[model samples]
Target: MGASLNEIKSKIASTAKTSQITGAMQMVSAAKLQKSENHAKKYQTYASKVKQVTLDLVSHDKGPSKNPMMLKREVKKTGYLVITSDRGLVGGYNANILKSVMSELMKKKNDDAFSVMALGGMGADFFKARDIKVSYELRGLSDQPNFEEVRHIVSEAVKLYQSEEFDELFVCYNHHVNSLTSEVRMEKMLPISFDDVTSTPSLDTFELEPDRDQILDQLLPQYAESLIYGSIVDAKTAEHAAGMTAMQTATDNANSVIHDLTIQFNRARQAAITQEITEIVAGAAAL
Candidate 1:
C-alpha cells in the first residue's frame, strides 16, 4: 500500500529535523577543523624545525647515544602506535588508520613478535577484537591535545623498546592535507635514525646550556613529545573535516529519499480521489 498524507508529512518532518541536526554539526565541525588546521600549520613548522635540529645534533655522534630514545637496536619485535577517532560517523576516519595497521600486521612474518598501543577508542577496540597484544590505549582524546596527557604512554613504549620488548616502533594515523582530503599514514617512531641525522645538516650552531649533554638530555624528550603532539593535531583536523563531509552527504541523501516518497504519496492520494468521483458519476448517470 502507498503511504498516506499524514505518513508522508511525518517522514518529511523527520527528514527536516535530521537535516537541521546535520547542518549544525557541519558548522561545528568546520569551525573546529579551522582551528585544528591552524594549529597544525603552526606546529608543523616547529615540528619540522625540531626534527631538523634533532637530526643535526645526532650527526657525528655528538649527542647522547646511549639514551633509549636515541638508541639503535636490532629489529626483533615490532611496536605499533595507532591513532584513531574515539567516536563514529566520521566516514572512513577510523577505518583508514585501522586498515594501515592491518596491512602492517598482515605483511609481518611474525605477528606474535609485535606489540601495539592505541590512542583512541576505535583503534583500541579493533586490536582487542583481533586478539593482538596492545600495551596501552588512551581513549576520548580531546580536540586540543596535550603531550602531558600521553607522556606516560610514550615513556612506557620507549622503555619497552629499550628493554628489548620491541626492537622498533611504528605509528599509524591520518595526515590532514585540506578540508576534503585526508590521507592514511603509517610512520615508524622508534630507533631514532641517527643515520637520517647526517643527511640533514644544521644551518645554525645550537648553543648548549652548561654543556651539550645536559642540553640534549632535555631536548630529546621534548623533541619526541612534539612529534606526538603534532600527529594528534593533524589526525583530529582530518577527523573533523571527514565528519562534516560525510554528514552533509547523508543529509543530501535523506532529502532525495523524502522527495521521492512525497511524490509517491501525492500520486496515490490523487488516484484514490479520482476513483471515488468516477464511481459516483457513473451511479448518477445510471439513475
Candidate 2:
C-alpha cells in the first residue's frame, strides 16, 4: 500500500511539473498570437489597397501596355517559395504545408527542375534532407516579421523570375482563417493575374506621370514584393495561433493526467490507512 501510494505521489508530481510548463507555454503563445493577429490585420488593409491601385492601373490603361510580370509563358522550370516556422511545437502547422507542397511536387517528373526558396529552419532543413534543390534559404525570422526582414528574399525571388530562372513562381504559406483555424494556400506570384479584380476599366482615368511602360516597370516589382511580405505577415499570425492552440492542448492533457493521478494517490492512501487499522484490530483479537 505504501509503495503504491508513493508511486502515485511521484506520478502526480511529474504530471504537475508538466502542467506548469505547458501552462506557461500556452500563455506565452497566446500573447504572441494577439500581437501577430494585430499586425496581420493592419497589414491586410495596406495589401488590399495596394492591390486595388495596381488593378486600376493595369485595367484602366489607355494604350497597349503589357507588364513583364503579367506575361504567361510555357512552364519549363518552376520556383516554389515555402514558408514554415523556425521551431516546432505548433501542432501540424509545418507538416500540413510541407505535405501539401510535396503532394503537388510528386506529380511532376524527375527531369522537371524546380528551385525551392525555403523561409524558416524547418522548411530549409526539410527540403535539404530530402535532396531537393533549395536555391535560397532564409531562417531566423521574427515571430512578427517586418518587411525589411523579408525584402532581400523577395528581391532575389523577383530577380530569379526576371532572369528567366523559373517560368512560373508559386508561394506556399499558411493562411490565417481565424485564431483557431488556418489553411495552407499556394498562390502564383508571377504572371500576375487580375482575375480576382474586376476587368472593367475605371471610368475616371488619370494621366500617367512618366508613361505607362516606365510606371509598370517600377510598380510591378513592388507589387510582387508586397505579395511576399503580405503572405509572410499572414503566415506569422497563423503560426502563433497554431502554437497557442498546441500549447493549450498540451496543458489540458497534463491537467487531466494530474487529476487522474491524484485520485489514484488518494485511493492508495486510503487503502494504506485501512490496512493499518485492520492489523491493529487483528492483533487485539489475538491477544
Candidate 3:
C-alpha cells in the first residue's frame, strides 16, 4: 500500500511539472499572438491598398506594353511556397496547411512538374520526407516577421519565375480568420490577375509620369513582395493562435489528470488507514 502511494505521489509530481510547463507555454504563445495580431491587421490593410492601386494602374493605362507577370502562360511547371511553423506543439496548424497543399498537388495534371519553396522547418521536413524537391528554403523566422526577413526568398522566387523555372506559382499558408479559427489558403502568385479589378464598377484614376510602363515595371515587383510578405505575416499570426489554443488544451487535460490521480490516491490512503485501524482493534480485543 505504501509503495503504491509513493508511486502515485511521484506521478503527481511529474504531472504537476508538465502542467506548469504547458501553462507557461500557453502564456508565451498568447503574448506572441498579441504582437502578431496587430501586425497581421496592419499588413492586410497595406496589402489591400497596394492591390487596389496596382489594379487601378493596370486598368486605366492605355499602353502598348504590359508587365510580363500579368500575362498568362502554359502551366507546365508550378512553384509552391509553403508556410509552416518551425516548431511543433501548435496542434494541427502545420498539418492542416500541409494537407491542404498536398490535396491540391494530388489534383494537378500528370505532366505538371512542381517545385517547393519551404518557408519553415516543419514544411521543409514534410516535403523532404515525401521526396518533393524543395528548390528554395527559408527557416528559423521570428514569430513577428518583417518584410526584410523574407526578402531573399521572395527575390529568388521572382528570379525563378523570370527564368521560367516554373510557369505558375502558388503560396500556401494558414490565414488567421479569428482567435479560434483559421483557414488554409492556396493563393496564385505569378501572372497577377486583375480580374477582380476589371469586374468592379469603380476604379481609381492614376496620373502616371515618364509613361505607365516604367512605373508599372517598378510597381509590379513591389506588389508581389507585398503579397508574399502579407501572407507570411498572416501565417505567423495563425501559428501563434494555434499554439496558444493547443497549449491551453494541454494544460486543461493535465489538470484533469491530476485531479483524477489525487482522488484515487485519497481513496487508497483511506482504505489503508481503515485496514490498519481494524487490525489494531482486533489485536486489543485478542489481548
Residues forming the 10-long window of minimal summed lDDT in candidate 2: 197-206
Stretches of candidate 3 exceeding 4 Å from the true structure: 62-65, 108-112, 198-206
Q: Is candidate 1 or candidate 2 better by TM-score?
A: 2
Each prediction's number of clashing residue pairs: 0, 0, 0
- Model 2 agreement with the true structure over 1-287: per-residue lDDT tens digits: 77788788888888888889988988998999899888878988988878877776776654545777888988888889999999999999999999999988887787356788999999999988998878999999988889999899999999999889998889999999987899999999997887675655652457777776787889889999999889899899899999989989998998999888888888888888999999999999999
Q: RMSD per prediction, one decimal?
A: 2.8, 1.5, 2.1
What shift in Å separates residue 227 of candidate 3 from its native position after superposition?
0.5
Candidate closest to the true structure, highest TM-score: 2
lDDT of 1 at 59: 58
Predicted model with the maximum lDDT? 2
* Each model's lDDT: 0.78, 0.87, 0.87
Model 1 CA RMSD to the hidden true structure, in angstroms = 2.8
**Model 2 stretches astray by more than 4 angstroms:** 62-64, 199-203
What's the true lDDT of residue 149 in model 2?
A: 94
For model 2 the TM-score comes to: 0.95
